[model samples]
Target: MTQQELQQLVEQISLEYFKRPFRHRVVINHRFKTTGGRYHLADHHLEFNPAFLTAELRTDLIGIVKHELTHYHLHLLHRGYRHQDRDFKVLLQQVGGSRFALDVGNRRPQAKKFHYICTNCGQQYHRVKRIDTRRYRCGVCSGILKITTKM
Candidate 1:
């Protein structure tokens, strides 16, 4: 969809879901890599990833829009707008917005590190703690496992 179309959709969703008008601009931001959308705290503008306009990502696009709208509306109303806040969570759930921004890439938790590889199948694994390669075999190929890296 075009930028104009995105703006209209945001406005429509804002009124429909939040019962408030989205007075600020909504723009398609190509620079946004991992995040689906972002709400600017200073300007109140919403920036959405253009990749989300594709047919396969339409649902994600809507969710991102709703998520950003939650921030916009709550911040405008001087309520709890942060993700951890109760009001934001309740409004987000009510609007059926995504609980967290969609990570386009594999966004494993930061605490996770130990990387394992299957010797037979060449399959990779990520873990939070080191696993015993001697005892464990590849679940798919039943081959000896090896530690590839630690991150």
Candidate 2:
């Protein structure tokens, strides 16, 4: 959705659920990586990940909005706005906000450690976790495997 639509949605949700007006800007921040949304304490602006607007991630979008709104409203009211606070937890539950942002697993394979290269055949291997190069060898040519990169 556009920034204007997101702002309207946040205003609507704020009034509907919290019974308070959201007098702050809501922007779609495409650069947001892991977290679904973030409420800026200094400026009181709410930022949402653009991925949340997609059809497959609508529920996550709502949940994240609620989560950020929880912080927004609480901080505005000078109440406990932190995740560890009771007020934050209670309000989040009442609003059906996600306790933690949903982990939509990394779209691309993350760089792995312990890259192994075959000595004889020049084969390459990547592993998510560390592997013992000494115990493993190249299947193609039974070549000794060497560590290429740590990550």
Candidate 3:
């Protein structure tokens, strides 16, 4: 959707749900990598991820809008606006907004993991934590395991 469309939608949702008119700006931000939307405290503008613009995720888009609106409205009124604030949580739930942003687009790669191998069967295993080689055996072959790489 165009920037104008996004602005209209944000304004509509704010008025309908929060019963408050959004006096600032709303813009689509393609650079948002992990979050669905963000509310700027400095300027009171709302930035939304463009990935949620698909027709299939219209509800998700609405939820994101409400989430950001919660921040916008609360901050404007000098109420609790941070995520940990009771007022923010209450308002977010009242609006039925998403508790978390939808994951869209490419995410950062996972941290390096431990790579182990079964000495007898050559089967490999990836684990987030280091395991005791003497106690833990290969699930497939029940063979002794050895760490091959820290990654």
Best by lDDT: 3
Instruction: Provide backbone clash counts, one per model.
Output: 0, 0, 0
Query: lDDT by residue for model 1 over 7-122, one digit each (tens)?
Result: 99999999998888889998888887778888999999999888788888888889989999999999999999999999999999999999766667634457768989888889
User: Model 2: per-residue lDDT, tens digit, 1-151?
Assistant: 7889889989998999999999989888877778788999999999888877877888888888999999999998999999999999999999999988777763566767668889888999988888777887888998899888886
Scored by lDDT, model 2 comes in at 0.87
Evaluate residue 99 in candidate 1 and report its C-alpha lDDT on the 0 to 100 scale: 73
RMSD of each: 6.5, 5.6, 4.0
TM-score, per-candidate, Cα-based: 0.69, 0.74, 0.75
CA lDDT, every prediction?
Answer: 0.88, 0.87, 0.90
Candidate 3, after superposition: displacement of residue 21 in Å? 0.9
Candidate 3 local lDDT, residue 55: 85
Q: Ranking under lDDT, best-scoring first?
A: 3, 1, 2
lDDT of 3 by residue, 1-151 (tens): 7889889998999899989999998888888889899888999999988889888888999999999999999998999999999999999999999989778755877665999999999998888889999999999989999999996
